[model samples]
Target chain A: MKITNTLLQMVKTVSITAITVLSFSAHAADDKVYRLKLAETWGPNTPILGDATKNMAKIANEMSNGRLQIRVDSANKHKAPLGIFDMVKSGQYDLGHSSSYYWKGKVPNTLYFSSMPFGMVTTEQYAWFYHGGGMELMQEVYAPHNLLSFPGGNSDIQMGGWFKKEINSIEDLQGLKMRIPGFAGEVLARVGAKPTNIAPGELYTSLERGTIDALEWVGPAFDLRMGFQKIAPYYYTAWHEPGSETQFLVNKRTWEKLPKDLQVILETSFRVAAFDMYTQALDANATSWSKMKAEYPDIKVRDFPPAVLAEMRKATDELLQEQASKDPQAQKIIESQAEYLKKSRAWTAISTKAYLDTQ
Target chain B: MKITNTLLQMVKTVSITAITVLSFSAHAADDKVYRLKLAETWGPNTPILGDATKNMAKIANEMSNGRLQIRVDSANKHKAPLGIFDMVKSGQYDLGHSSSYYWKGKVPNTLYFSSMPFGMVTTEQYAWFYHGGGMELMQEVYAPHNLLSFPGGNSDIQMGGWFKKEINSIEDLQGLKMRIPGFAGEVLARVGAKPTNIAPGELYTSLERGTIDALEWVGPAFDLRMGFQKIAPYYYTAWHEPGSETQFLVNKRTWEKLPKDLQVILETSFRVAAFDMYTQALDANATSWSKMKAEYPDIKVRDFPPAVLAEMRKATDELLQEQASKDPQAQKIIESQAEYLKKSRAWTAISTKAYLDTQ
Candidate 1:
């Protein structure tokens, strides 16, 4: 009887302990803090891109009521800008911001999320993503890599680049060394130009030091800021990238761990950021161009010669076809984008373009 | 002799011309065909406002390839809707559209604009305005004055109507006849119903049926649409009209004179109408209810339950003072609306209060 009583007492104690442990865990979970780390390829002050990150942070903080705090670190602070996707997917970082085109090697389909050479406008892209299932496809592309993506900001239409030598014809591109990226870079490479990939921060130095013969880094606003005019007198309006979209990518694991409320906040904030960034870029670009003309008279701004443009266009078509043939996902996105563009173009041609031409 | 010769020649020519003209010419401007008139209260659609009108004409002409041309008539249409605003402003039947809130005196802002007693949901309003802004703002206000206005469209964040109801305590509103438009009409009037101004088409029926207790029209949107709603719902929700904007107004004179561009082609092909009336309204309003329910379910979706919301907030104070002290332009609009409401409310609010509250 004594032995049985002792065994019973032990069991009772163990049961009580187990129950206490379970209750403690439940209580702790109620007050759990979710810390999210965000890595940005651009610096904190990089115009719309920077503003988007700040807005994202603000909304997340407000929505979470401080429960989920996101710490954003610049590119070099964590990893190289090009490596952001890999880092996030590998669990080295919880979140990341970068241009999807940068990872074209790893995910060819990502090019659609960014911009094709001479592709859709910002508004058209927004329509495609929000209404035309582009967003869903983008997620599908990122899913394989274990990343969830949201549009961060749009640079709108971009100028070609600052050229050390004027590109008068297709022949001028032969043997030229230009800092370009994604599909455009491939096209340029095929045309015999030595294509180089240079980060935005390092672009000015490379151009100034003659390491690169020419470089494409957004439009006059950012190009002017980087002092490209000082080194490259020939500024060519590439019109290669009509609209470039940057993205905010979160590690799937970290994203799933977030509370439902936090998720809403993040998505809403990013959407608002996208809207704000597009307008802000437009306003800034307008002012920047005026400033460039007034302040830097030596800088010559010219449109790409028709001959060169034609060649580039031809190359772009071929490159896209080749990419689509190899990657099914790329083909799917390209098809959808093409269809949307075709319809949108028909309407916009008469409405926006016609009016603009008349003006 | 030379001077006399010259003078004689001039006198002879003048006399002959005068006699010939007198015999051949005597006609009013209206007597001419191929005259196009466009009527809108403000300057021709600027970026945010008249973009539709501009695009409409452009698209129509392009589609028809210069075969059709439109001439817009700005402001002061024949006789405006809701007095001078709607009739001429609705741009004579060829094309007309604007926010429903403008005709609140007829239908009440709540019933016309998908209004909530406190605030309308953007999504629900979008759904309600399939024809876009709604037929109410136009039919009640403009149609009576020999005009027609379609439901153009709107963006987010609308102002609540202005009010004279001294809602010091929720109880003070027990029998109050308030000018509430859109969806708010059903909810508020249901609690303590009274008579509201219904649109010209629905007015006879609504009045006969005793649907609404009061009504409220738009501030800006109503101004653009016209102020019929104000006449019915005495108390207004000024907090709701912060960012509500709309388009669509035409003058009878201009409509009659419009060429193909301004007439059928431009009016029918208005790009903004195509975009905003359908796309913007649909997208914005689609997710509104879900978002509201998910975020603010407890946000009191009811009328100021007697004294529940009697506490005046900052927005109310500033809006009232601003309206009272108004700028010339703003004052003209405010005084007209305020005076009209004051007279209407004296009888509507008091007489209807007893019956409504008791019921």
Candidate 2:
């Protein structure tokens, strides 16, 4: 009866003059189109992050032959850059693109999905996500919210951020005010520094007017546009977020409604887009960093002093342990990440690290 | 008239009992399925390399909803592990899976597509391929062969090779007998090493019986199975092939025959599969390296001395400059890759290297 009804519906809709095509596929319902609406944290025309959604939607549409049409609403349209998780969970939007760490207040475990302070690099973390039980842990965290999540894209290795003053020691961070966010901010607070969040629009003015002493925007790619290089003399290397990965959230019900092929297409498109964004970020960083060197020779590149970094690492571990003691799920995720990082880092030390160091 | 004829043909094919269902659409030709035959250069059930082809085929099949079928033929069936280029080029097979450098004898430019001595790592090379001018240059090379090429998968950073003795200096490499194939062999030859290509089947016995003093197979993932760790106590780090990427070849004629959707599906599948293979190699290496460490406590991991690496680097540049002088195309690719490597590596040094070093 369902098949009969679907056939009738298809005949009425496809074309009354083209009934010959209907008999060939008795399961016309399987060919039904699925349209999804996505809300992204980034504004339209945003570089790598925004490009990921557009790239994903285009590929999904072309591969599904227009069966899967994803209507993307950037933050301008959605007006909820930080509320993506809530919107996706509440079914206000069928999908979302945002960094997982944005939901740390609502779901503490969400912080692990994005790059952790001193966590694995991009490829190593990718191995962990796909092969090291990261996806399972991610699902466990999101399942209660009635959402499904995937790696949306990577922003490449995020720089430690720009600093107006050189951090010479642990003393240098004492009562230091910097614009950092989420868990890394907590780590900073624990180490006697004041970490604050500022709106993107006001960051430059805030830093310049002595409202903040330092800031860690994204790496060279995104930071170049903010004119941070002109004000901040020290461009520190990465530590807090080694390989930050953004995520795609799907309303569980919306995902269930998709046919098997369309589901595969949508998921594959997301995976490809995520990898492409990482590659794109790598290129953009390289290009922008080169331009920065040539254009601004005085922008001193610095790594945080060993004493400062060691203190920060200690604080990070302490914070992680505190959370682990309080939450079993957090404990499990942390332990899994720690063990995987040990083994994966060992292998990396031999392959990638060795290659890089020798070169 | 074409629509009328297609409708009449569909009516004649139908049982005539469902005449009402016969007019949905006259373009049944759109439903025609496409089957592609892929020849891989690995025997049945070979590990990571073989899995890439199968993985690609499965994803392409699932996404295409049976509209596209890919039949993968292993080297055991095709009886030509090295003939993939010829078979794919001549249209005997629609596609093929192999390494690009394997065809250096036939096409000198093919060597640059694979890893080079002291070149960019996997992610950097990937950035070069997708964002930089790699794809265009690669297309220029393969177009003449009537084929399209893509990054098939990465085998990770290959170890310099297993050796019976540690290489302390350039003097230690004089007259060293090693089983290192392709352009790395040329580099070895310049360094006064007798680089010989030994059949995979004879490698173990040759190394054990003193026929070969050393050999560089793949890394720990593929190398563990060959029992090299048991025989060669001195395991060296990679230099010859920093990031060995395999190639996926599509016959030009076969590619043209694909529908736009299938073409997109196939291409996306290729990208995902290639990335997946790299992750798989990373995980496999970590796993295998862990196992090897446990079982072979005598195994010693060594990096070539700074002096030795300097000589090899010099040899690599000289050989590259020699190739550039001979072919303008080679010079273009070499220069592009060199330029990309410098910028990308600078970013990597600041980002990935900084992260790794601090850890």
The most accurate candidate by lDDT is 2
**Residue ranges of candidate 1 with Cα displaced over 4 Å:** A1-32, A199-202, A205-211, B1-359
Taking the tens digit of each residue's C-alpha lDDT, what string does model 1 give over A227-345?
A: 88888898766456777888989899887886554565466556656654664565456446667777888977667766677677788888888878997887899888887766554
Chain A TM-scores in order: 0.86, 0.94
User: In model 2, what are the clashing residue pairs, if there are any?
Assistant: A18-B23, A18-B24, A18-B25, A19-B22, A19-B23, A19-B24, A20-B22, A20-B23, A20-B24
DockQ, all models: 0.01, 0.52
Report the C-alpha lDDT of model 2 over A254-274, residue by residue, as the tens digit. Answer: 999888888999999999999
After TM-score superposition, the amount by which residue B108's alpha carbon in candidate 2 deviates from its true location, in angstroms, is 1.4
- DockQ, 0 to 1 scale, candidate 1: 0.01
lDDT score at residue B320, model 1, on the 0-100 scale: 40
DockQ measured for candidate 2: 0.52
TM-score of predicted chain B versus true chain B for each candidate: 0.37, 0.93
lDDT of 2 at B237: 92
- After aligning candidate 2 to the native by TM-score, how far in Å is the CA of A328 from where it should be? 1.0
TM-score of the candidate numbered 2?
Answer: 0.95
